[model samples]
Target: MTETDIPALLALRDNPPFEKMHTVAISGMGPVGMVAALRLAQLGHDVIVFEALGGLSAEARASTFHPSSLELLEQLGVVEELHAVGLKAPIYQYRERSGAVLSQMDMTLLEGETAYPYRLQSEQNNLTEIILGKLQDMPNVTLRFNSPVARVERGDRHVRIHLEGGHRDEPILAQWMIACDGAASPTRKSLGIAFEGTTYDDRFLVISTTHEFREDLGEDLAYVSYIYDPTEWGVLLRTPNHWRALFPVTDAETDEEVMSAENMEARMQRLNPKDTPYEIVHRNVYAVNMRSASTYASGQVLLAGDAAHCNNPLGGMGMNSGIHDAWAAVECINAVLTEGVDATHAATLYSELRRDAAINHVQARAQKNYDNMRQDDDAARAEQADQLSAMDRDLFEKREHQRNSAMFTSLRLTLGRLKRELHAVKAPAVSGGQKFSKLLGQGPVYAAGAYDAVSAKLVEQAGFKAVYVPGSAVSASVMGQPDLGYIGLAEMAEAVRRITAATDLPVIVDGDTGYGGVLQAAEAVRRLEQVGAAGIQFEDQLAPKRCGHLAGKALVETEEMVAKVKIAVAERTSAVIIARTDAKGVEGFEGALARAAAYAEAGADLVFAEGVYSLEELTALRDAVRTVVGGRPLMVNLSEAGDSSALPPLELAHEAGVGFLIHPVSAVLAAAEGIAATYQRLLTTGASGKGQEDWKQFTTLLRQDEQLERASRLAAGEA
Candidate 1:
């Protein structure tokens, strides 16, 4: 293919034409695996589910299902069955040991956000069993009980599993393998992926009893209550037939001591003192860990639920997010089998989206909740309680309800995190680079600067051809620090990842001094490649890097900059590498143009001269670099208007045949100004209200309508 044919070629290769279903193997019969099996089967894929155990356990596990989970389950047509055997807790409370209510969030406030807003006080077994029942009825599904998956052999295009049960002589082969097995998954172990995280010092001690906690605690107490004490923080949960209380067993205690009848009775008595000993029906202890696999997808095998991640149960995020992963796994596979998406692209997209969910959402929130409940400083803890108490009912209900409900989902977690735009993890048909290349075909188009997923959404909503994620913006918005190189490679890449997930627009990210030297720049190239960065521009500025537009900038030697450019081009997978020089401000304009040409000659896909003093210099650099790029467009960094009077306007740049313009600080400036005004309005008026119509408009940016359409189609038995 010719150089100019790259766009049409990538565009064509991205959307290959074919559709074929294949057999899928699901390991483990937990809620995650069951949901995967059911969804895949419902979508008409041949599915075989292997369970290590003979049958489902009635143990008390993951009793509180969130509203977001309910909405997702509703899509699968299982919410009604789940509700049939579950109790709805519309209100949950955070309480002091003295029974004083610190804060209570009424789920009713989120009724409009979700169809079923309350936490369903039902064990995870209910959902698994319900799905299993449906799976058995479906002709596309086959269940294998008493069958433990020993390991999986990955093939080029499929997976083969060796079972430990009597099926050792019979290796089962399938096109896809989803390991929803527990944290100690054989599939994950076999794949050799690291499950990196920490095992908490405290072992969880759970006691299930016939005692009615709501009646004893008080009528005002909700069915779900987290009571805090410096000595011991306890969680009181109501199951369908019993009340379960969970406490932390320190290293000083053993499982035998924690689960002993006397200790269990005393713990229950402390929760609700009674004349007679509390009726402890069952008692168990298990270690809790906060961990997620390095990657959720590998070749044909995909890890879901506990196999991919584990977390503290305080927020009930484990099972809910796992269910979300299960759906993602199925959706991605379906995309490959039916939607004509490339198989590897579909799998990688699932890994990127779900691993993000596991790390940033599930594990992070669980750890935060654990820390919140076990705050050691009395004054600080009391201050937090006071803040919760003083928070407006509407505000508290809105925030806490979503937080507790796991509404801050990873797929669309931006609003959930930034209170801005949420990341939607839907699979895009084209790679970011492919999209970017096609747009570059239009000639001299600019990218709107996005500091976060929120701004990326705004840029897409406003119809920008591409997104420019600046390291300066990350330093300013995230760290609240000036762009003097406070952030590193990982931080900037994460910003790009979140922004890329928010929209289909191509994102060109800034690599400040390559975060170090040549080796570091190579790693930056690889990291940016993994995160779907459409383009990456590496500058020649020294450490403690200043923004390109700022004064007192310095540039490395021309050979050094060229070496960085050479390494980046050699290391990148699909991202376009634009070599940038800060020489115009540090050296001379001619020297800057010389460095840009040198880097371009050294194999840079594009070239840029930062701190260009005038439109004349931009045009000169553009002409110099085009000789090496085979007619590829030139790039310019356009900061805020206040930053420089020498910068050229858009019309003039386009007129000059410039292509790739970057408004690197526009969104940050707008966001800062809007935030200042909002805070001032709240201070002056004692109220800051956002109109429902405004929220509606914002939700559209998250693709809520597309999400609803998919859910509607799924519920209506259409794939």
Candidate 2:
């Protein structure tokens, strides 16, 4: 493509011709809805955006745009315009009320990770103006101000949106509808999806002033600073023309007492001891909530922005995450309507991923920021200070901390982690089986054990080939119970379901004692397969089976155990069935070999010789099992505490002919030990024992540098 034709060519490539065009109605013309409408129009869809208000309101709301949000705006071709009018804040600080910097987070650390690595301080109204201006220019987009959506009615083919008091009485009909209304979304309420979560008892007072506090203090300060004080913890943020202060108001304080002109002047004066009374231009009070819709989409009606979820504004993630929701909704909508993808499946995945990010990242981090600032207990405050100091001292930890605090990594991380899940859900059903078999042949695979979705994601990022869901680890971590077969088939299957959904890595679950007899073993296989297990290891132990290394373990008859193995193998379609025998502790090494041979004969794809006492024994067991089932894989359980003949290096296991080396409890064990030590240090010394600079570098490695660069190039029209 020549330079002259490049723009047209790139536009054509980016905007693919849709097989079928769609009319999408979006309610609530806030930033979220407007962005969604613009994106849909770009994707060759007819978009109509409705607004309850007569026009955009110049309200004091979220004013900081993190790197991720900027990247999203850049994708919509408005970041440059925003940056021209917005102030760039490269650093933000956590400070004491007395103007002492406790810790400073430099957004520049995200330099290589995102296109726009600094926080942009601008009024929310500016963004609205830019988006509204763009929307007005799009021929395919319809902007309807003062057109409130009364109710959303879903039909078999399309969605009908009823307007409350519009000039036209006819209801709007569209193939898809997105709700971008605020938190008290009428559409969400009409759909009956619970907006469930906590609402803080304290109301926040936000005040704007033109007076320059930094000039009076005579010290360079971050554009945004969270001040910690037991008496009056609050947040200070700078906008283009004004500085804003947000303070918490307790039940003891009345609105009149907190919002009075004298109170506002006093609070601002306390920060800098101004020569004259501080000028407060405007002030507003509002309660913060951590609420989310049960689902983002129901039928053809989808929810975005505050309509789907809302959270405390401490981390400035509410609007950012809502924008993310808008993009995700449009992508899924386009995929379903134009790309021949399943609508229900795409919508469900959107709901699952966005809701998860909102709750786990946005809400959780906002709560942490709030708690860190308002901690009253002396020891707790000291510990929090130490943690922040550590983040400041270590660039890696600081970058990771800043990523979450700025909401720069929320969307990227969420979607990146869910890529495999999206593929699994959208791909042909037989792909899972094929993928599992292919992964098996690629052994000797090292599988990390995980009990939760977060751990599973970390394992996937750590470059593990698969996840091993150990019964012992799951029982201990999830239920705080011992691994004595207390966790049944249903519980284990559910755990596998979550881990598998969170990642694309093949997961092998420990089906202890098959949860019962042979019939139960068949049922267990079916349940695990249905929930997306790539493989399951069935151990040869009686009901209530204990850990292999633990005492009081009993095994069923060899024939009976062989029967269960056969049942598992027969019931599973694409799931690998590995038969594990705990016979070493009871029937001696020779007897264990015999049981392994029988299980192999019963069509087990892999044989696990549990509790081998030495490297020699493991080698011997692998050789013997190979003799019984030529060329078939053998699994080795490398437990730190279990009777693994020797904890040989992974290379040695491969040399010894072991196909799968499973560290059954290593991940959770290390996490538990680390957390315990950290907590113990905090309890004793009121600080983390490790030096401030000595922190794990995992989060740094999780940064999306390449993805951000790609987005930057795309936004700049650099094909």
Candidate 3:
């Protein structure tokens, strides 16, 4: 593909409808680059992507797509093609080098959770090629192959990038430049930013063996199978019809010295040492490194994919994380150019968000994996295994002890007594006819479907103070949640101030995880008070809180949560503080009640026990908290088909002497079921569209009217 082959641009003058003021030059036509370009094009931005190679990069780097990443591709219109060309791995297996059965983790465990519950095997080269094909069909996207940017200069409002292989010596000027230029980014280097991290000195020989192990390993052996041993460590993984073995190289030897086909077979013999016939067909050396950019964006120039961060492929995080970075970059860039918001602020947030996510989650997990794989000493391994066994045994012992211990029961009664004592403490009396109202939905609405119209219309017409979460086809599909933010105290206060700008309704701002530690919650409360929110509720769940509906969720320590409540209470000037406990399943009502009573003493205005199962539990809770909290509100998660007891929300609210009831997820829950159904239909039909004929019309309602109007004007100017 050449610049002249950009079919849409060649016909632009004839079309007369194709023109734009701000052109975003996306460097690199790799998967990350292509996805970003595609999203920008769909948003009616003029996108010119530069690729160094004549076509797609030929490196067979990433050979599989994670389910989460695949969902993003499904939104981008390439998931079907991926499934067609790629092998779906539904089962994961682990085995000892001596063919001993260890443990196998089946992806079937994730069957109902995600639409695509398995990984797909397809080379990154092919994936890039496919994305390039999609970009070619877009009228707003220009794919400039064999043209790499030699230099990038960022001015106050525009960016200038000089291409090496182009006909002209003149540089291309655009509003933004994204460097998806792979692991070694010259664009990033040109900005004088240092990538901070350590590169692993130890290398591994990655051999692609033609020998099929499926017959012996079983057809279901499509997984990340690790062969554990101190020395001669290896990992056997599937790639379509072939198998790849990763053999670790010792410290004294170099790749050339230890990775020949003969030596490869020898190492495999040492690790496997089995009767199964597996031979090396191809051998290559890989030096895994852990590195992240100090910054993701420098002025108008930004980084994505491997350019931003790279990690060892221990849990297949390296490539998947890059894909996530691509989605984030697209959202941030769109917010800047289209929304006319603070692009700099958005970029800073993006950098920190992606960088922290990769470092704390991916890099940390990779390091832990290395420890798990390279465990050498026999005594040490034995001790570790024994410790694991002991922990499992201890779980049973603890449960039995809890059942028998009089101390445990006495502790519960003492907490109950504390609750009664706190209840006796008089709450400020409600003045005659004095009204207090809590504004809900200060954040984005997540549910879609027919309910989307209901939720959107409700916010639009309710006269209730609220804000709309922007809806983008790419963002809405990939992030699996609406984008919402308050940034800092000032920004949050600004949001609250604006809600009252239109109406007098009190706002209930979603203070996600309290923004910081318990010590900081008070400061957050002070900030929220300035913003004009009447109340703020902080959850017991940890940061980057999983969607409240997901299972196997973990809650934070009870004491730490109580401390946060205390901080929130100490900090609040006017805004009411609500403490939400997610200890329903992770811990039972006893733990939940204990935490709630503690929070009331800490000065919480309301106590919320989420995920409660029955009226019996809800009644018990209301009776328990009434003693300590007094007339302060009690809130319960009102679920239609949820575990919040068989009691209706209003009746329960009245019975429990609860002052408030929050439907934190009513609209979202309804939206999820509908969006999920629509996704299923799209997957089955293999049709590319906005779903129903009226979907295009319906989506306009889903967006913030003013933002969409602004976007339409921008798109029109581009056309």
Clashes of each: 4, 3, 13
RMSD versus native structure for model 2? 26.8
TM-score of 2: 0.56
RMSD from true fold, candidate 1 = 23.5
Estimate every model's Cα lDDT from 0 to 1.
0.78, 0.79, 0.61
User: Judged by lDDT against the true structure, how good is candidate 2?
Assistant: 0.79
> What stretches of model 3 exceed 4 Å from their correct place?
1-22, 165-169, 218-220, 273-279, 383-719
Q: List the residue pairs that clash in candidate 1.
A: 414-422, 414-423, 415-422, 444-659
Candidate 3 lDDT, tens digit per residue, 1-719? 11222233223212322112235888887778887888788778878888888878776567768776777778888889878888877655445566554544445445554677667877777777777777788887778878877777776445767676544423565767889988788788778778889878778778787776766666656556766667755678877657788877766886777875567777766654557656566677877778889998899788888888888776666776777777767766776655555667666666776777677767887786676667887887677556544543565543332222111222233234433432233324321101122111111111111112245355545332332211111123334444232243444445445543443334555565676677666777777666555667787877545445557677778778888888887776656677877777677878877777777777776676666545566666655663222232466543443544444444333344444444444455556677777788789986534546466556555455667788999989953
Cα miss at 207, model 1 (Å)?
A: 0.4
RMSD of each: 23.5, 26.8, 27.5
Candidate closer to the true structure by lDDT (higher is better), 1 or 2: 2
Which one wins by lDDT: 2 or 3?
Answer: 2
**Regions of candidate 1 where Cα sits further than 4 Å from its true position:** 1-22, 165-169, 392-397, 400-404, 414-719
Model 3 has how many clashing residue pairs? 13
Model 3 lDDT, full chain set: 0.61
Q: Mark the 10 consecutive residues where model 2 has the least summed lDDT.
A: 12-21
| Candidate 1 lDDT tens digits, 1-719 | 12233243333223211111236889999999988988898898888889998897556688888877787788889999999999999888888888888888787777676777688999899999898788889877879888899998776456767788545224566778999888899999998999999999999998888987666777787889887877688888788989888898898998788878888888878877889888778888999988989998899899999999999998778888888888788877876677656677667777877888878767777787788888889898978777677764558555664654555446455213321211223335667775665455434546779989889989988866788988888998888898899999888888888988888888898888898899999999999978889998888888878877678887788888889999998998768888888887787887887887888788887776566446677677766764321133467666663344456654454434355666788898888898888889899997666678988988887889999999999999999
Better of 1 and 2 by TM-score: 2
